[model samples]
Target: MRMTEAELAQYKRDGYIVFRGLFSPSEIAILRNETARLSAIEADTVIRERTGGVRSIFRVHEADGATRSAAFGALVRTPRVLEPTRQALGTGEVYVYHTKINTKPAIEGTVWMWHQDYGSWQRDGCPRPDMGTFALMLTDSSEMNGALYVVPGSHKRGRVEPYYDESTSYKFWAVPKRDVIEVLKQSPAPVPIVGPAGTCVLFHCNLLHASGHNLSAEDRWHIYISFNACANAPKFTEKSRPDWVVSRNTKPLPIGPDVLNSGTEAELVRATSPN
Candidate 1:
């Protein structure tokens, strides 16, 4: 799980890196098995949230995903993911802000536009440190499974404007062709992650990134955990998934609000509150 000086330098300059075997075969088996088990339940089990009439996939924390996969949770603290991040951020003072799983079905039109992760946490120009996001593949990920597309080193451009709307998938869930061309022409080309079932990608929150369509024969499932340095972060942000929660550990975060809760206080509040 050791990240070399060269790899750390690459992340700082190139913006993202892929580690094909972040999880062992047995570990991947457990995750895939559990994910299938959850999906088999009759009901949609998945909760959905809307932003201006657009439905964003959301699933309840600990309800749809495994509650006790130490192997998986260990990813949050794993040297494979953390050491590199610490090297990139130059500190181990980190916090696990939030986590959510992504499962994209095979579809010719499915898309996630290229955008930075900053806007979701920024409010009123309160400059804050961006979170580091890691995507772990539960299933084999490829261009067919709508693999992620990233504009190498785009984080240097500052936060790109995010556009959302209810009109069409291509509109809200697409990276502008101009930006794609701009990055390609001016910077390194977007790299398509190609790997076996257990590939993991670590990306900076401010990286201008987007995922491609998953028209292949396999389902592309990914779980992302947001991590941030305890240093220089804002107190809170005005955002929530309503379907997921954030768990706090030794390191603290400066986030405003979230739709999901995982702390003991939140559980107590949910218990006493009427459904």
Candidate 2:
């Protein structure tokens, strides 16, 4: 469904909007099962946390030289996701950038440093900051389980300086701690995004956001589907990451209806597997 004017206004003012229960329980179950199956496999792209625990499984949609599941493709193209994207971008054309499922194990979950996703996109030569992510909850998220946190209206600051941290062995594209503190001084305190499975958050690419470590007894899982305005596709011919990491195809996604059914887990496993 298209976002209401009030929702659009809030996104303009706050850089994010939360939609509670956007997906049904059964729909969430389908995604959760798929995530579990994909994450168990060992792949170079499936990164681990700093402590060497499973971090996330990227590109769940595109697998085995084809789109993995009809349900996933439908979810990506659903008006529930695409309408808001088009409205927020002020453009009708949108293209898939990538998608990933972040799995944070209880007790051993690691923290994600505060960062704007656009910083990395800029490095990839995306001409404008017209990208955003729709983060859908696959498992319940609570403060005790490392829920995502965002600084209200931080996207207004646009892209900030980023540097590499050798200790983390990952490129740290987030702003400095002092800058974050300064922004916090002017903005409201970080808001923890906590909700049950089926909740979703749509945030601007340049929004300053992060999540703490999960310490609760249950695992926390969420999928991030990034979309960019077709007009803002990357300008560079060469890419630094794999196709799954950053899609080479810029085709606009076609909207479809929900495909959820009362299928057994085993049935879903076969349906979602490569043809």
> What lDDT tens digits, residue by residue, belong to model 1 across residues 197-226?
779888877787777666776677777766
Q: What is the lDDT of candidate 1?
A: 0.58
Tens-digit lDDT string for candidate 2 (1-275) = 88999999999999999999898988898777777776677775577777776787766665354325445655676678889988888888888898877889888887888888987788777889999999999999999999999998999998987654443424446767887788889898999999999999999999999998899999999989999888888764654566776777677766654455553545444444434
TM for candidate 2 is 0.90
Q: Give the lDDT of residue 187 in candidate 2.
A: 90
lDDT of 2 at 47: 73
The C-alpha lDDT values of all candidates are 0.58, 0.80
Candidate 1, pairs of clashing residues:
146-213, 146-214, 234-254, 235-254, 235-255, 236-255, 236-256, 237-255, 237-256, 240-259
* Top candidate (TM-score): 2
Q: Model 1 Cα displacement at 82 (Å)? A: 2.1
- Cα RMSD of all models vs. native, in order, equals 7.9, 3.2
